[model samples]
Target: MNLLLNLILQEKQRIDYMLERYQEELAELPKGTIAEKKVNGKTYFYLKYRDGRKVVSQYVSKRNLEDLQKKLEKRKHIEAMIQSLEEEKRIAVKVLEG
Candidate 1:
């Protein structure tokens, strides 16, 4: 039982560190979703996100759209990992307590 408890404690620490790192990465990555608009038969992209109390939309040129989209996708993946780590940490804590 003691060995199992020690392992759980170690796993909890690892999860905590991973959660912190993922959160920091998430903060550095781009935020918001891409919005497509058609104007005069030409399609354009915009990066739409909320700023404070207002919704902000910034035009994204074709050249930068791919890079921006990649960054947004990375951000989403990291966010999901953070959530999973949090849940794991919660379970670890529950195990430690019991």
Candidate 2:
């Protein structure tokens, strides 16, 4: 019983550390989606996102579109990870309390 409690405590510590690190990483990641617009037989890409109460759209050059898309996808993956970790942490706390 003692060993199990120790393991749980260690796991809780690790989760806390990882949650902080993931949040910091998330803050640095870009937040937006790629939107394409057609004009005069040509397609242009834009990065669209909300800024406060207003929506902002920034034009994205073709050369940078792929890189931007990858970053946005990475941000989404990190968000999912953060959510999972939060749930895990909540469970860990409940177990520790009992």
Candidate 3:
């Protein structure tokens, strides 16, 4: 039926959009944590990440702290959106099949 065809096309477009967004959002992720250390009343910041079994760290300037945090949050949000898209794809597939 025309309705089913339209539904499939709309779902396909939505999936394509989500996939493109996923790829773009991946670049926004900088998977790491900002850590602080205090030494002799002086404070220091480090960006912490994992490499296999070992943990790696690098210095993060105070000026860049906010930017990194926003990137991390964006990455997390994208991950959640990807999961939601998976469910949408499943339903769409089922609809197409039935």
Candidate 4:
């Protein structure tokens, strides 16, 4: 049971590390230019840039950012849940032995 708990802890740490990497990558993206477009009767965000030829990223609106945030939160929540379950299992093993 101790061994199992240790493995679960390691997995949680790995996911946390990956999440940090993703956040850093997102932060490094250029601000570029902002444009508004109506799609499906809702305004959406678009980022445009020029090097030699113009470049545009697909719409990345506030709603999209919020959705990403929610996903990250869910990932973290799962990691925490795994850790909690591992602890619970360890405790149960101890109780049964006693």
- State every prediction's TM-score relative to the real structure: 0.94, 0.95, 0.78, 0.35
Error of 1 at 11 (Å): 0.3
RMSD values for the candidates in order, in angstroms, are 0.9, 0.9, 2.1, 11.6
- Give lDDT for model 2: 0.93
- The 10-residue segment of model 3 with minimum total lDDT is 23-32
Q: 3 or 4: which has the higher lDDT?
A: 3
TM-score comparison, 2 vs 3, better candidate: 2
Tens digits of per-residue lDDT, candidate 2, 3-98, equal 998999999999999999989999998898999999999999999999999999999999999999999999999999999988999998999999
The lowest-lDDT stretch of 10 consecutive residues in candidate 2 is: 25-34
Ranking of all predicted structures according to TM-score, beginning with the best and ending with the worst: 2, 1, 3, 4
lDDT of 4 by residue, 1-98 (tens): 88876665666566566656655554554544556788799887665556668575756768666654455455556556656656665665565455
Clashing pairs in 4: none
User: Which residue runs of candidate 3 sit more than 4 Å off their true CA positions?
Assistant: none
- lDDT comparison, 2 vs 4, better candidate: 2
Query: Which runs of model 4 end up more than 4 angstroms from their true locations?
Result: 1-63
Tens-digit per-residue lDDT, 34-60, candidate 1: 999999999999999999989999999
Ranking by lDDT: 1, 2, 3, 4
